[model samples]
Target: MKQRLIILSDLCGSEKSDWLIYYTHILNQKYDLVYYDSCQLGNVDTSSNDQQIIHQQFVEGGIRKAISQLIELEQNPIKILAFSIGGLIAWRYGLLTGNIKSLICISSTRLRKEVYKPKGEIELYFGEKDAYRPPMEWFINQNVKFEVIPNKHHEIYTEREFAEEFSLKLCNIQSH
Candidate 1:
């Protein structure tokens, strides 16, 4: 049987324009890839609530719910690949659930706080031009492994080739 791999999209739900297709394609070759859209996972009321609050609640609550569902699924040794704010959610889930084997976070921050601790191997990728680079002190203090791509941003994984390579790396890691 193929290993279970969970791919969390950006704050928005699955859109044809996003990197979901690329990552799913790569993992489909060797694993049972599951796509979780962050938007649909939580209660988002952007009409009246402050945008930041909506986003915060969405990330934190959505992650908690996702972790609960994953635990119920009883999939052993799950790996998570998350994008943008979804990465922060994954980090929080790792801290709370302790079920993730490895996590790949792309262009994500806001996980520097003490509340969000990663319990699994974390590979953080940020664009050199990303505006939201967490301070080096944060990574140093948290002891997280990170990498900076040459030119990209929150939507870097939209590129098919990059997503494929990233998914392959995750698969390889999962195999070991």
Candidate 2:
């Protein structure tokens, strides 16, 4: 069976995008990858912008709702490749279900705010220039695996090849 992988939204999240579809096509050779953008997961106002979606997710019950939806969609253990706020959501779910095989989160700054260690092997990637990045000692102290990518926040995963390659490596996944 193909390994199951779930990707959550960024701060400026989207449930779907041409970019995501294109990337997943490349990844599908090895895993069953699912991408959920903000628009698809919540009871979002159709007109809401990225900022509004991000606010609704953290401020309201958006995070919890997303978890519930994920559980309903797949009961078996899965892997996660998430970004920003989506990383936060994926982190929460990993802790909640303990079914996460591997979790890879990029630029998830808010993770510094909360504290819940999940069962999965997780690796966090951050741009050296992102102010939100936690200190290196913190990861060492917490025993969390992480790395500092070359670029700043916006540019960290800008290159499609880099994003795709790095994400797969983090999960120890190989695509056909």
Candidate 3:
């Protein structure tokens, strides 16, 4: 009865980020929300091991695994909300298969390298301070809907205000 929303986590790999929480609060009444954490590796406290494991698990290989996991789940039209590396992974996967109904990629600067377009309604967000972000002209060239949040970074997903603002965007999007 409710729309299914799948949230893919960032390179940092926390599926329950503030953005997720904010969107859940706003859309829970109408959507079934699920969090998908990418293949997790070592703890952040152990820097070297964490870096090595994360790189090994969540690179190109992890994108395939994430897509497989999504398809391997129940067959349903899913809306996706992804961050950073997760956004790139989701974009890659979504392009391969038309499984997503809509997609929102937040701070997924690395997506610039990908040439395939997704089969769903797509929107992207970036922060001015994001070092890896694609130029605004690039988004315009690609004709992808995007917004640039002022004076923020890739970590804006964890910020309460940013989350709340993003939640509003999601709310407004589904209303039509």
Candidate 2 colliding pairs: 14-37, 15-37
In candidate 1 the C-alpha lDDT for residue 60 amounts to 59
Question: Model 2 compared with the native: what TM-score?
Answer: 0.81
Candidate 1 C-alpha lDDT tens digits along 82-172: 8876777677667666867988888775565544565778888887777777767887877879987887775677788778778778667
Highest TM-score: which candidate? Answer: 3
In candidate 3, stretches whose alpha carbon ends up further than 4 angstroms from where it belongs are: 15-19, 40-53, 173-176
- Provide the RMSD of all predictions against the true structure, rounded to 1 decimal: 4.2, 3.1, 4.0
lDDT of 2 by residue, 30-61 (tens): 77777777435644444556676556655587
lDDT of 1: 0.69
| Better candidate by TM-score, 2 or 3 | 3
Q: Which candidate is the best by lDDT?
A: 3
User: What is residue 172's positional error in candidate 3, in angstroms?
Assistant: 3.1
Find the 10 residues in a row with the least total lDDT in model 2: 14-23
For residue 54, give model 1's deviation from the true position in Å: 5.8
